[model samples]
Target chain A: MQLFFFKSINLSSMEVFFDENESYHIIKVMRKKKGDIIKATDGNGILLEIKITSIKSNKLIGLLLKKMNIKANKHSPDIGICIPKKTSRFEWFIEKATEIGIRNIYPIISHNTEKKKINYDRCKKIIKMAAKQSNNFYLPEIKNISIFKDFVVKKQKGFIANCSNIDSKKFNEIKLYNNPLFLVGPEGDFSDFEIEFAKKNGYVSINFGKQILRSETAAIYICSICNNANNFNL
Target chain B: MQLFFFKSINLSSMEVFFDENESYHIIKVMRKKKGDIIKATDGNGILLEIKITSIKSNKLIGLLLKKMNIKANKHSPDIGICIPKKTSRFEWFIEKATEIGIRNIYPIISHNTEKKKINYDRCKKIIKMAAKQSNNFYLPEIKNISIFKDFVVKKQKGFIANCSNIDSKKFNEIKLYNNPLFLVGPEGDFSDFEIEFAKKNGYVSINFGKQILRSETAAIYICSICNNANNFNL
Candidate 1:
């Protein structure tokens, strides 16, 4: 069944409206007609099976027939990556991260971060598309780009993955309550000063492994690890 | 110091020849002349510090001043991923996995795998480029694309990661003694029969995480998890 996006599913009337852009896609691009069955999610926790009742130029009305909530509440890594040199690459990170089930994504501007200016709106769109494509319930939370120092001050369980041989504590040993954040630097890696600052703030320096990985590769790796942490008997 | 790739680094004489390809990159592209110093790796386990001496159109020779084997020799994951829909995406997987220290990568043909043809030489080149870019010494071993059933029967500690919620053992919990292999299916995932066959052959059914990921994304995720199993403890 084709999937659609609905902000909230009303149980009483079983009616929902899609965004203007998405409505156009359904009526014009997809040629979806009335009584056609479709899948829709609120990008929160609601997944609904709906049938189109009416289609307009900028709005589509649907009757929700059945509803199911895909519970996405779980312990997954919140990987904060320093923006890359290209915005497209960074956008690619958003798509993959959403598919990988990242809980939260923070775009940080570190001393070595190559790309400073980030398009928050575009990044969010990529995240939504990936989420819908993968049939995910929750969308990854995107925070504004903060300076490395300010980000390091957070008291959350922290880890910094860099290119240095600074033997880091393994991910399993760390106590993961609910949300654990892993910090990935840019191509040049976090500066010596940034590492020391994180060290002082009690952010454990961790290596993703032996091989040196690209900035985006490191980010995806950390996210996968945190997501899979619960499976391992640590 | 900039890093360059040389075919071989002589230990006794501490001399090496930069291939015509690399020679052009250094002498013409980067505009570096004789007497300049740079770092070079043979993509095996050797790192060299050299000073430029003779430069020609066909060859560039450098005198090595110091030789050190700073290669990181951590455990590697022996996993194989099915060739994805887009050949370039599968090629990219080989590149990133090699950079992240994967031991063996095979292009398997499963029920849902799109691309059947395997270009052994082209895939090897991709791994080489990634190894050089990531500054890693070891090159991941690439195997010819094998049939799904044939490949599963030959390997042990094999895992099939799919989209289903079938209970699976976490990677870290599984004892990885010898080289282990995991078969990642394409975007469509493995057929029911394939999964049953793998299970009968002692292959464990696994899920990378709760979220649904793309084929290439799943390949990189599994590779990172298997390699960094020990990293979770910290």
Candidate 2:
């Protein structure tokens, strides 16, 4: 089933209207006509089974047959990863992280981080697309870039992923808490000073074994592990 | 330290030679000169630290200063994922699986699989690139595509990832054996017949929680879990 995302819309009513772009997509792109059933989401944990009632010149109206509210996953961890210098890599991280059920993503800037500027709007679009594609109604919150020091200080408990020789704890051994955050460094890795600062502020050093994964790969791997550990309650 | 991949080389002696492409990269691209130290791998669990001795017109000669053998990760899982119709997604899976450590990859063809043809040579190149980039000397063995039924009979253990409502076991609860192979379906997913056959033939159905993930993301997620679970011996 294909899902389309609509933002800033009240879906509580029985009938709803789609904007110009979504209307064109439904009528022309998808070749959907009257009485066609479609799955749509409001990017806020709501899934609607809609029936096309009418198609106008610039708008399309649909009647909601059923609504399913997916409860937000409280166990999903918060991921604070340094944005890589390459835009595509960071975008790929965002897409995979959204698909893997991350609660929040904080793009941090460290001393060794090469990329400083980020296109926040483009990242939001990627996250929205991935969320819709993955059948996730709740979009992962994307926070503004923060300094490494400032972000570490705010976190009460979590692990900082780094490959330095600091006798870092293995990820599986750590006990996860609700809304726990994991911090991943840039390609060059966090500077020694940054790691020390994080360690002093109650952040445990965690290593992903012997493999030297890229910054984006590390973030996605950690997010996947956290998702599995928390959602394994089933 | 950056590691470069050199195929089919002898590291027993104190001196070694680089092929034309590697020579050009070292001498022209990297602007490396004599006495420069570099790290290189043979893609077969051998890491060599060498110092450049001379730069010939077509080749570069280097004297080995140190040699280290990275033991193969016996815990990495064997991934049997269907080759997705989109080449990029399948290629992305190959690259990430290599970085996260997979002993072997079997590209299977099922009833619902859209794409049938696969370029084995191209996939090998991708695995090599990813292995070298991640500092993994043991390159994953990429097998040719096989029929779905034929592939399922050979594996007695391991789990098949699917979303059907059949009380699939959670990944964390399963006891992972050595070199376990995980079967991930294509975009349309394995047909009902395929799923039933797999279940009847001793393959446990496993679910990665409620979120619907893409085929590639699911493969990487499973690989990450297996890597963490098996390598946590520390």
Candidate 3:
């Protein structure tokens, strides 16, 4: 099954209008014809079954036949990661994280963070494409960039991944939290002071394995493991 | 401890020579002093504890203080994946698979295989770097590109991930194989004939999840899950 994403859906109108990108994709690219049925999500957990009513030059109008709210994945973890300097690496992380089912993404800044700017528009587009391809109804929110100092004050209860000497449990060994959040450090890793601060704010240190992982790779690992441990709880 | 990769190791000499890349990284980037102890892996399950003896412009010399054969991970899976056309995607797959502790990689070509060519040297370098970063002593073997016809004849017992209608179990639910081999298809996916042929050769169908994944993403997902399920068999 394929899924398309729309930014918004008006319940009162009972009609779906394809955006410019989706219109071109549905009409010219996919060659979807009028009266054809298709699935679409509003990226807010609403899945709509639409019957194409008209395929104009730049617009493909559809009548909503059915709509249902998708059940949110209870095990999806929120990932707080130091944004990498490389755009490709961050894009790859966004793609894989969406596929692996992430709840929220915190593009954070730590002591070692070199790149503080992100192309939010491009990132949202990538997220939308990934979510559509992955058939994920709920779009993961990309929280505004937060400095490690400010982030620790939130008192988020989850694991903090760092390549430092800290008494820790293996990622899979830790008891799953209700709303798990994983904070991954930058290439240089979280400084001793940052690690201690996070620890004081109720974040427990956890190790993915013996080897060191890149910031983005570590976040993906945490997401993958969280999905595995929670979705297939045996 | 950070791990470096060496192509080969000599037991008799009890001496180690760092190549230009390693020498530069050790001497320039990391700024190691004389008598500094560093770890090196030959990618053949051997680990060397080396002590810096001399440093030069393009050469770093070390004495092998100790060497030992590391135990191999018994549960590492062998992945047979159709090569993606994009260089970055293929490179990303190699890096992540090595980090996830894949035993071997077979770059295969199926009915829909588009790009048959691969830069073996570059891929090997990526594997080495990822293994070193992940502290993996054993390097994953990158087999020559095998056609699906020749690949199916091997009679490997493992799983094939496809979006076709096949009676399948969740990857975690399926009993783990001794040395798992996962065959993932290309963008167009394996043809119906190929899927049946693979089944005849003892490959079972397994689903990663409900969502569709890109070819490289699927391979990485399989590797990640295999590592998680095996390493944390609790």
Candidate 4:
């Protein structure tokens, strides 16, 4: 089934309206018309089975036949990673994380982080596109840029991926009881002081493997492991 | 230490010459002078430490100081995956697989595969760049496109990743003795006939997780798992 995404619409109501852009996609591109049924999502865990009712000048009106609210995946990770200096790499990370079922993403500005600014809207668009492509009902929330120290103090039981040779446990070795958050450093990795501070704040240091992975690779590897571990029941 | 990649260079000899492009990069972009030391790789498990002797119009002469030969990672996976229709995605897969320590890559032309012809030279360049960036000594050999049935008959103990509802083991559940190969399908997945034929020829079916993953994502997941499992010594 082909899926479409919508934003800021009330999914609870029986009637839904598609604005100009979506209308163009539905009527002009997809050639969908009245009485045609299509699958649509609002990026809020709601999947709608909608039937087109009418087409106004440049708008689309659809009646909802069914609304399915998908429950959040309990095993998704809340990933806090230092934004890379390269924009494309960071955007690629967002796309993959969304497909792998991440719960939330926090772009942390650590001591070694070179990129501080992020295009939030563009990131959100990428996330939405990935979710629709992968059939994910819920969109992972992209948080604001966060300071390393302030973000590290958050009360969450998680592990920080670092390369500091501190005899840290392998990611799979730890027992996960909740949706754990993982912190991945930037290209140069976290400074020694940042590692010490994170350790002092109850963040357990963890290593992926022998090969030194790039920042985006580390984030995806962590998310993949978490997703695999969580899907044992399925 | 910064690493540079050079092709067709003799590592055992005392003198090494850089061609026009490399000389331009070293002289203009990086601004290295004579007597400066640099690390270079031959993309065949050889790392060379050389000191610049002289600079000509568009060439660089260097004297070899030390030579280091890196052994191939015994745990690297020998992966056979269908080439995705999108060139960028296929290129991205090659880059990630090289970083994750894949020994060989076979582009299989399965029934559902869309792209048949690949730019072998471009693919090789991408692999070399990734190996240099990740500090990998050995470069993965990219094989030519092979037909599905002909490729399936080759005697190899491996698993095939598919979305079929048949009973399949998780990637980590199986024990890997030698460097095992993994077959990933295209966007449409393998045809039922292809899967049956592969199973008849000794390929076991394996699943990544509950979610539907893209072709490249599945490949990376499989490689990451194999890397982690084989790195028990580390």
lDDT of 2 by residue, A123-159 (tens): 9989988987787878899998899988888875778
Global lDDT scores for all candidate models: 0.76, 0.83, 0.82, 0.81
By DockQ, the better pick of 1 and 4 is 1
Clashing residue pairs in candidate 4 (N, C-alpha, C atoms within 3 angstroms): none
Candidate 2 error regions (>4 Å) = A6-13, B6-20, B23-39, B48-69, B154-157
Instruction: Write down the worst ten-residue block by lDDT for model 2 chain B.
Output: B5-14
**TM-score of chain A, all candidates:** 0.89, 0.91, 0.93, 0.92
lDDT of 2 by residue, B119-171 (tens): 88889888977887787878899987899999998775668898775767877
Over B1-234, each residue of candidate 4 has an lDDT whose tens digit, in order, gives 556765445556678777687777777878988999998877777888889898988688888888888766567788888989999889988988888779889999998998998999999988877876777777899997898788889744678888886867776577775678889999989998888888888899887654567888888877777777666755
Clashing pairs in 3: none
Stretches off by above 4 angstroms in model 3 are A7-13, B7-13, B18-34, B54-60
Retained true contacts (fraction), each candidate: 0.68, 0.76, 0.49, 0.34
DockQ of candidate 4 compared with the true complex: 0.42
Best by DockQ: 2
Identify the candidate with maximal lDDT.
2
Ranking by lDDT: 2, 3, 4, 1
* Cα-based lDDT at residue B80, candidate 1: 72
| Native-referenced DockQ of model 2 | 0.68
Proportion of native contacts present in model 1: 0.68
